[model samples]
Target: MKRALSLLGYSIVGLTSVALGGCGQSGDAAPEATEVPKDFASSGPSAKAVESQFGTPVKDRVATIGLLNKRNNLTQDLVMKTGESRRVGNVIIKLANCERTLPWENPPEVGAFVQVFVEERASVQEKLAWHKVFSGWLFKDSPSLNTVEHPVYDVWVKDCAMKFPGEEEDPAAYASSSSAAKASGKASTAPAVAPAPSASPSAAPSPAPAAVPAE
Candidate 1:
């Protein structure tokens, strides 16, 4: 009986040691789960909608131009002519966060196009939602870009007023065959642009062609 009791005590101690060892191992084990960060990308659909209207991604990144301090307009300026400010004007835009590559014409099979995208404040997501309501009014009267936003003209300032209707002009849709892309070769890296005419005030104005094609 004495020998049997001693053996039972030993067995209990051994079992206790094994249990403690397991607890220690479990406490020291590495974590079993991990989290990955979300990837940042340019806005995709908004960018695509704009790309469909405009021939290419004109600017490397989305840009924002403030409206005339006086008129406070939010319009898109996507033209690519010299003396034309490459940044465009008078609107604020936060770039979309995803990018996708689609087939584009080298010689530009489409007619004149306007790069279209929603404009939003740099700090807010909901700003773009409100922007859609008034975006249609970007163009109404032709106000000189300088006269509209100059600090000196602040006396004419107004809030929440839309002064222009978005009357866009598309000439590329009807232009001649010269604008088609090359059928079988590498795509051209060169931009589709025309020579800038000298900005001489005294240059005799040519008669306005009735049906001008878009560049």
Candidate 2:
């Protein structure tokens, strides 16, 4: 009985050590395998053509994405240009393209083609590694169309910043111009006052002239 108890205690300690070792894996570990295509994360040859009906080119467009970590209940906003990827904690998010409905379209919608990679193990026996867990278009108005089925993270599209051919001028530019105009108007309206002349010493009295005249 004593020998059996000792062996059991050693086995328990070994198992605990193994579990701790797996849990201590750092997120920076290189992934053993990546299912994403080589060109998937980049602006490949297919992206050379402009896809927007609006005048804004695809590469110039920007997108805002929301990332949530359910484990810690923390959320972060990722603003990125097309074909950009950002790594936060143990996950990497890549943006391929983002789009929105035309001004005339009914029921406007925004979307982005995103891929999410997380560093984790598939099972207890597997080593900690990177995995491409989600890849697809995430729609803002209609989220149920597709979803990120991760247990610890969630990603969604918030907005796509782009321009239509005749869309209104940029708000920032417009505000700056208005401020400049106001300044000019104030300057013009304010009356200018010339500087007053300084007082000068009076000329010497004509005493000499008067004395000569009297003499």
RMSD of each: 24.8, 14.6
Measured on C-alpha atoms, candidate 2 has an lDDT of 0.79
Residues forming the 10-long window of minimal summed lDDT in candidate 1 = 155-164
TM-score top scorer: 2
TM-score of 2: 0.57
Q: What does candidate 1's lDDT look like per residue over 1-215, in tens digits? A: 99999999999999999999898789444332111111111222232224334223433333222333334443333323211122122222222211222222234211111122223454655453213212111212222322222231121111111111121343333333344544222244332222224344335455345336533
TM-score of each: 0.17, 0.57
- lDDT of all predictions, in order shown? 0.30, 0.79
Worst 10 contiguous positions by lDDT, candidate 2: 193-202
Highest lDDT among the candidates is held by which one?
A: 2
lDDT of 1 at 13: 100
